[model samples]
Target: MTYWNQEIETMDPVRLRGLQSERLVKLVHYVYEKSPFYKKLFDEKGIKPEDIKSIGDIQKLPFTYKKDLRDTYPTGMFCVKNTDLVRIHASSGTTGKPIVVGYTQNDITNWAESLARGFTSVGLGKDDILQISYGYGLFTGGLGAHYGSERIGATTIPISSGNTERQLSLMEDLNVTAVLCTPSYFSYLIEVAEKEGRSLKNNKSLRVGIFGAEPWSESLRHRIEERSGIKAYDVFGTSELSGPLFTECPEQNGMHVWADMFIVEILNPETLEPVKDGETGELVVTTLLKEALPLIRYRVGDLASIENTVCACGRTHPRLMRLTGRSDDMTIVRGINVFPGQVESVLMKIPEVSPHFLMMIERNGELDDMTVQVELNDLASDKVEDYNRLISRISHDLRTVLTLSVDVELVNPGTIPRSEGKAKRVIDKRKF
Candidate 1:
């Protein structure tokens, strides 16, 4: 299957904006007519489809949050008939409710095509044997990755998450040339293999690894590549946005957005105004072409920026900088916004700290409490004086950047539990 529309992906910014405006106008009308939730919202707000003449007019539309989905419950927000929906996927109910997304047969096919593009962008093809380690059922990650590999004509080994021994045994027996899994589990798999006296670096068959479902630094990417003897690439998307919205090419500078399907925008989370090119802001997405559950101007909560400059890979589709952090993940402590990813970055830069760390935010008495629970690589080498000194430096760094003070405690490595899926890095112990 060739590209759906080549010119649109390579369209210049000026023309691209025009295409987005036209599509956005049509989508607004479609949603208003078909979706009850949106119809009531538009009528109550005295808004008309004609009011949205351009993409800039999206600000006039009310922001649709995860809470809106839950308030509508199972089927109230559905734009199409139940018979039209080919699949349903839901996230874990972590913060009170799990967001549910529905897809038509066309929607599922489009999703596979998008993911297939991601695999092809990283040189995955029939010659590659893919071992998928993501969890299947309910959750979208596993099926999305699996179907994408199938669409790309790769030999797939459906090795679901966990079960490290079986995963390794298949890798050796099948001589798996590539693996698709979360970055955290991939790291843990390598760690377990070493303890079992297995060799991953010496495996000549492995060629590439596609890691995602969490935020990871370039440092972590290098570590994965070194340990697994393969090139590591990043993939980005959410269940609401349809997986494989963007993916890294061979160059690995940034991920390329599939512009033909998604009209990606970076807007200031507070102001709701578009950020200039190259400026970081919360990612706002508008589905240019979707039949079922087409979310218009959906706030993804992911913070990132877009670059229009052409890539060395010769795909003129815009590039997105690696995700910095999520808007939901940002904590307001004493009127200052702090991100756990920032704390993780700082901790990772320090050689003594282990990769596993947690940021705890709670109420101590009346005041808000912020503390970084760091796992030290060597327990024997850890000292109270050293902990104090290092935490002081970290406190200074936070005060300099975020204008907030925090406490840091050094704990032994392996004290914190590892996450096979999405890592829980932040713990808000504050009670309402």
Candidate 2:
């Protein structure tokens, strides 16, 4: 009951490193032999599989990028034959060609096992009814969480994101104990329940929530916990890495990355070398167990850090610190870098404002101006002076954190469009 796979999850750090080294060596050889794309890349780098003798030698291996997946297109990067693949998922292709990932039966089993371990650590089990609000289909969040919940023997509501009314009604009717979705959607759901005179804080059955699919701040997590009366936990994964692979244990510190399955590296943005455990940098991951499409030192494009310190929950695996922002999602305004998570941290600390916000960037003449549209909670007064004062205070805080003067517009609660999936926090209109 304490752990889904206690032996592995609580494996000694020394042994975990040994296991990782062994796996890494095998993975290098496997990819070189199985994947034509990887073989070509390895040959060009003059790196042999035996060169990766230990995890420390990971630097010698060529770093893979999301762009590599796009260049390979549909099946160019898959290590397994088409007959070996059982399923496939892909990115949205919003930028260019979608990055497609294939899964063999073993890959699917391992993905489910990864999430099952996470679910158990978060206290989900057979008696709990879980509602999965993440979008299904090519998107991995919904299906990924679904199998994990089932693996843990929890009754799952395959209610993909949207239809807030039904989502809430089902939660109450089925006495669901946990809900999985993006933090933004769940926050919006709480707002909707309040508008419909059914505040989730009053919902007795629901006690746990697993939120991810987009970056969120600790402040927002606290706000959701306070508003909905649920233990809000962060889940981490990407479509490329078998979605929803890690979740924070009950300790609520950081999401544990299973070392037996994958290797995580946070690299200095400039040096491309590994940073100290707690230092913020770009996240690079290597799939040690994946067979359908194994990635070696894949650049995940997210800005985050790792913690080698064992968790209070007694899981020996390393923890991935909360994501600060994505390299691609950052907005530069007036030559200042701004991440939506930074803005959320500031806004959530203010009692008068809702956690929901939108950033708009525009170019006027030669200057780029940034505007943050913040939502007001019910506690905010209706007086014009109060509104102006609140706006000025928010603008001041934003300027302090972002180092750029920002225009603040107070919108009514729920005025911002709510997303059923990942929240769109930034709208940049400037033509670059």
Candidate 3:
């Protein structure tokens, strides 16, 4: 089979583990020496760099939380100075402050190579014309995929999300062979094409889809493939993990996690201990090769399992099974990460609205829709015009924080049910 970096991708399992162990040994010392955050954390936990001599000793290290990133803010967690960084990307800050990550030149090159391996695994190469539809700027998806496509010597069209008509036009005119985008956006494209009397199923050039940025199911995969006439492959990564890292092979099985760069563990969310192989748990990752912002045992919060058995595609790297859900309450809508706390933060800023609110998510056709059901304060005005103004204002504020438009429904003070224990803030109706 055609491969990218075959030497590492198909390395023997015993040798791969040895490589990971060796890297782990160096990474512990590197982070402890370079990053004040890691040093302080290790010191506080009464652990030393020498304690992590092998991959098996990873459990001895403390886990890094999403809150830790917020606590560090912009560059406190970075190992390299600003001048040494080649690129910077941040999370949406749905919880609090956005988690910022930086990359050195070598880090960017490794990131590109990681994705190039993914693209080449699916038969895309120099001759393919790739259309990247992920959003650019601040977020990592667009540029991450762009660099990888170029690294593979493919002709890339950096569409950078939105402008549906133009996107479809270029797909036809440029003879685009592959598309990189969220599954929801791709579904919307199909709907737009159908309304314009165009048929993606009949398109001659499009052959492959690289879809990620949100959890999707096999049923959605089948639907996307049927409508777009392309084999849909799931690409998984977070901006913290060098964005868009792993992808499914031609067999269309679970996504292969590059063992040489990352050491992934499926651990019990409650106990923080490893789960038996093939059993679902929280995904914890330690970066073996990341330079600017190497993370050790960072809790990714996604719920998934790993298959230790070799993939049918002949890659030795373990495959991450379909992600079941997130360990936290974060939700993704139209590819943007959202948390209930962000909505609450906006609500608290408005005098007319109370904190008692419910967020509902549903799938309308192929698109995911969000509705914020909020209660008005006791002293709020009852006039229709005033309520309209309030709704408009609240919707705008929420969109600013979430980066996605949500329908806001202002209800009476006592309309929403009161809870004596923990409050229920979200009601998700989507099946996947």
| lDDT (tens digit, per residue) of candidate 3 on 282-320 | 999999999999999999978889998888888999999
Q: Which runs of model 2 end up more than 4 angstroms from their true locations?
A: 94-96
Residue 331 error, candidate 3, Å: 9.0
Each candidate structure's TM-score, on Cα atoms with residue i matched to residue i, is: 0.88, 0.98, 0.78
Better of 1 and 3 by TM-score: 1
RMSD of 2: 1.1
Clashing pairs in 2: none
Best by lDDT: 2
Query: Per-residue alpha-carbon lDDT of model 2 for 146-199, expressed as tens digits?
Result: 989898999999999999899989999999999999999999899889888998
**TM-score for candidate 2, residues paired by index:** 0.98
